[model samples]
Target: MCEEQTVSLVDVLEEDEELEEEASAVLGGSDSDSCSYPQGYVKRQALYACNTCTPQGGEAAGVCLACSYKCHEGHDLYELYTKRNFRCDCGNRKFSGLQCKLYHEKDAVNSQNKYNHNFFGVYCTCRRPYPDPDDQVEDEMIQCVVCEDWLHGRHLGRVVPDCVELQEMICESCMNKNPFLWTYAAHLAGPEVLVEERRDESCANVPKKAEVDDVIEPSCKRSREEVEPSCRLKVLQASQQKRDQSGAVFWPSAWRSKLCSCITCQAQLSAAGLSFLLDELDTVLAYENKGKSSEQVHQGHDPLMSALDNLNRVQQLEIIHGYNDMKTELKDFLQTFAAEGKVVTSEDIRHFFEQQSRKRRRVDAGPFYCS
Candidate 1:
């Protein structure tokens, strides 16, 4: 996390470019320009031909410096250039752990090894045949039925991890299929949609990674690429459909995220929740041990129990929504834990709740939906 309080976005972009060049030099690549950078980051003279401006059977955009394609109105070149990502009115690509769905025009090579825009190849999947939208004459490519766009898979490379390539854009279908990815994407896409955390003004300049003390576990490092190859299983359990004793809905498949699939990642998320619970429980237990009356303990029990129940519910929901099959298993586990003769001690409950909570965090709550 950057500690600098007044760093500008422009400076950050420049730094990324500098870092990219330095990295290329260190790696002994042909040159910094020869290496692939995100489309937006390419220099203007190198990436002027945007697919959005290319017309069927018509000349490409003339105003473009590098190629014939032109950029559409309101497109933020700086954001794309700096961030190496963009969502044009042309449409945003959804990462599906496979190939990108959008058309990726290869940049043309400059003397410095920098490629010009409009030189990107059209990548298709499985050598599907279709018409090229760029020329609109019958050229071989994969056609997206939903969007009616041409996608060349060869340009996307042989294997795209959980990333679907469509129309030179990322495919949303695969992301929509996964719950955690969708939730994370939605939050990243628009912060206004999430419940805002009240941050102290003094901490405005602080980076989030620095504020947190715990070391990140390995499972939490699972990228979308790791999760894309597995087949998603959907559980058809009725208990999964019903609301719990509390006012919470249960979603299945909470453990399928690249992060949640690992036991280590599950532990990390649970520890966070359990830490808070233990603190509250300790405060209550302290007062009780000091000769507090039954009424006090009893009163404390409701709040404590509510917290426990909520934690449990959240865990179950995380598992249910995180992975498809885990939802049914989680529901069964909850029911079994609550049944007669079950060893449901406080410690057991606490441990179970924490384990599940960790998994919830591991499985980003976004992959299931995007609004």
Candidate 2:
């Protein structure tokens, strides 16, 4: 009996090892079965957000790699992860607000290319996107408050007394157009001015007649030169605050006007309008997809399409879906499992799917149905 038990245990161990190998094969298999891209079609680069261009409703959107180099060169760009199996949408009627400068036969340009900045990557007095180390100037480059372009210290000239004192510096062109920008000073003297006012208040109790005379005519008057700096500083501070709040770093220019009408902006505006209409028109008739052909409409739409539309409408109404809840739960489970640093096996995936299926079945079954 003891020998038989030992042989059975060995056989059970061998079966377990085989099952483990099979599970590994199922979970860590090659993805050759996945869809393949066409030959000669090069993979597109990652998406990038153009800080220079503003989308409709003031939200920012990502542009294609070509758009970033061609149109948004020298403009602030934030890179996003590469999206697989997608074409470049820069200069398209949905992503870019301006025409494509580098648009060619290879580019996917449409009616969206309305206005182009004709950006050639040359900017500032140095005429380069970045400072050339060959020049060997130690002065730091400052961004122009108006044009939003980085200007070398030499280009700004004597306008900026010291680069250290520069918080927000306006370009020469902007200052030339609006001379008032030149007079902006720092508002650091506010505390000092308040201290002087407090000192004046201490002398208010001296004599009634003296106090009245002091109120009518100040003991000391600040000269135009002394007061101008403080006034300019206050103005500058106010302007900076306003700009920061509005998220507008660039100076207002004609380029902005052209950008506002770009394809990206038009698409955004259309989407927003449609969303507004959908919300306003909550009737069943308005819920139908307008893009459907007469035959498709007559044939009765796919249940999946109707379900998705209903889900969107319900979400708009602030109603949560069970599927979304299930997704969140699954996401949390996967995250937690990954965090534990354990190798997830096919068993884990199968178990998760089984649990979700059971839950779905329970939901599909009426509440009155028993075990």
Candidate 3:
């Protein structure tokens, strides 16, 4: 466990490129230049909601990456990131006058597709756009495991652990709606300990890895041996108030496995439309892992190896040397910016090369003297 460190949104802006890299990781380097309508609903793919076509408070519409470029170029768009089991809604009735150029025919509606406030370009209980123009407060946005909607840390009404990725979060609404989870989390939750603290002002739009210090073990963590299986649920229900407050609940990884899957519990879970809770693949982490696996299948080898395969040994060695030189020099040059926490720009790269060029020139023209 470590003390939590909060970073502002302005610090996140520096990671625009990092956001793209993270998206690529989730997308697994899928070709986004072409339309994806013909493919039907992708298991998991990068999604964008065109605000220009489907405005907020209206019909929610999402488009695949290719459609975002070809169908709604220059349109106001919300990067919904990657979503599971979604198809392109670009040419549908939601577009009104527009049709997807890549695919002429698409179903008017995708029944399996899911939508949240994110599709309308708003998120969290606050119902505001990310980096909200009206608000200046800097905070981290957390995604609820149930809704898949991003919520600000402040609005979560709880402390976000440093290692959030390692833990699973279920919002208060979801918790209350499915109170049975309280029993499972209490038994499976790990202790969040206080330790060395570090802060990452990285990409705001991406779910980066962090640490956890506190677990969700509430008063419901009584010894099961003391109570019969039939009476366990009642005891947990009665002791639910032992929790501090109604806030986002974090559980250790694999907490779902420890959840009571008895007939009664399953019946209750199914009644609440949460049978997916017991499914291992239902989690966002599972979706991301699938994306990564697909990416690995799509990209069989490192890009450098692919390039080297086409080159002669001499050319390959030359390329490797150049790469090494650039890597070393760039790292040395960027150390100053890293220390200062400055955002490096294209101009900075150019300036670094210029400095390198000058140093190389001075080295080559050693022992120069004016007589």
Candidate 4:
């Protein structure tokens, strides 16, 4: 977001000649020279009329630079430039609904507030415009995927780790508006998982080439380009289309604006065991985890245990039973040693494993059992 700046009529009059030429070209043989400021008023500069202020059918209306400053101060005014040589219609009968308050056309408007990001000269946390005339810094600016507004890297407060062309960046404002978007951004920004390596003495016996491969190779790797794509844009567009078709008034405008079906958001929802439909009228209804049971389970269980419980139920049962069986045998063994007044050292445990291997070789039938 940027603070509104007061624009002086003198500054508006001195707009570059190139802009005027472009506007003249756009008008194409329309008598550009014929249009001038009202009689006895010196024509200082040419300017494009505010499309919003122009009567619905008269969108092509143009205004002089002074008239634009006087009448359409807060309006979204387009710059047509000097070549178009247009006069102000702000005081004309066509715009009788809106009266010009500035008597001296050269003076500045009191409150030149701008509502949309399009009118902003600068944006983001830094609040500096692109190609800042005063500052010669040449850093690249990134456009927010959601707002489609440009922002500086420093303002975003993070280095863009991936190639921008391949991935879209959602602004912080957008993320704050939606929990799903926040999760998606956090997931993207989180540190990557690294493969663990065994540095035990036994690993020394492994072949040098194989050992090198084991150390360098990651358990899983994904390229930055692969991670970020136009999928989010496509999902947003589809969601918007669906909303337009539904014509449902139940959905809040704010929620509708934040609606997204990006892969990251979908994956996050899936990880949380949530199922949802994009076109559903009620987002709360589409979400599967809304029930009190899920909420209770989430809040009551330890996070670690809850995560483990998410594994296959059969595997979970096997792990519990296996641990119990191992515990029983270990207790029995310890009791036997206590009765004999003998302490079981580390060597004894190593020997027992060696003996078990030898027994396995001799039997050559059933699986080896250590007792």
Candidate RMSDs in order: 30.6, 21.2, 9.2, 34.4
lDDT of 2 by residue, 1-371 (tens): 45322223334446877776443332222112221112112222234556567433433344555566567779766543232223444454544447656543334332221111112233466676444546666766665533444566556543233222313345556545543323221111011112112233221222233422233233224454443322222333344422111111122112111122335444543554322211322211121222123324434765645666756575644434676687799778766655665454566768999998898788778588457
Worst 10 residues of 2 by lDDT: 184-193
Clashes of each: 66, 4, 8, 0
How well is each residue in 1-371 modelled by candidate 3, as lDDT tens digits? 97445343335445765675466466653457787777877756778999888986679989988888888889999988677667888889888898889888788888878898899888999899987989889888877877778888777655677667777788878878876666554544433222232433222422212321112233224564553445345444555434443677777677666555778878887888677778877676776776667666756877887989999999999779878897898877766666677666666678889987897678668887889
Q: lDDT scores for all predictions?
A: 0.30, 0.40, 0.71, 0.43
**Model 3 bad stretches (over 4 Å):** 1-21, 29-43, 190-245, 262-268, 289-311, 333-371
Alpha-carbon TM-score of each model against the true structure: 0.18, 0.26, 0.68, 0.26
307 Cα displacement, candidate 2 (Å): 4.4
Q: After superposition, how far is residue 163 of candidate 4 from its true place, in Å?
A: 0.8
Inter-residue clash pairs, candidate 4 = none
| Top model number, lDDT | 3
- Ordered list by lDDT, greatest first: 3, 4, 2, 1
Residue-level lDDT of model 1, residues 1-371, one tens digit each, is 97434433345446877775443322221112222334343221112223333332433221222111222344322111111111122211211121212334433322222222222223243322223444444433332221222344333221221212111122233233333333322211111111132422221322233222112222234674543322111111211322112111111111112132335434533553222211222221222233234334445766544655756777866544656655665556545654543433455546766877877676656466658
Better of 3 and 4 by TM-score: 3
Candidate 3 C-alpha error for residue 322, in Å: 3.5
Please give the lDDT score at residue 110 for candidate 3: 86
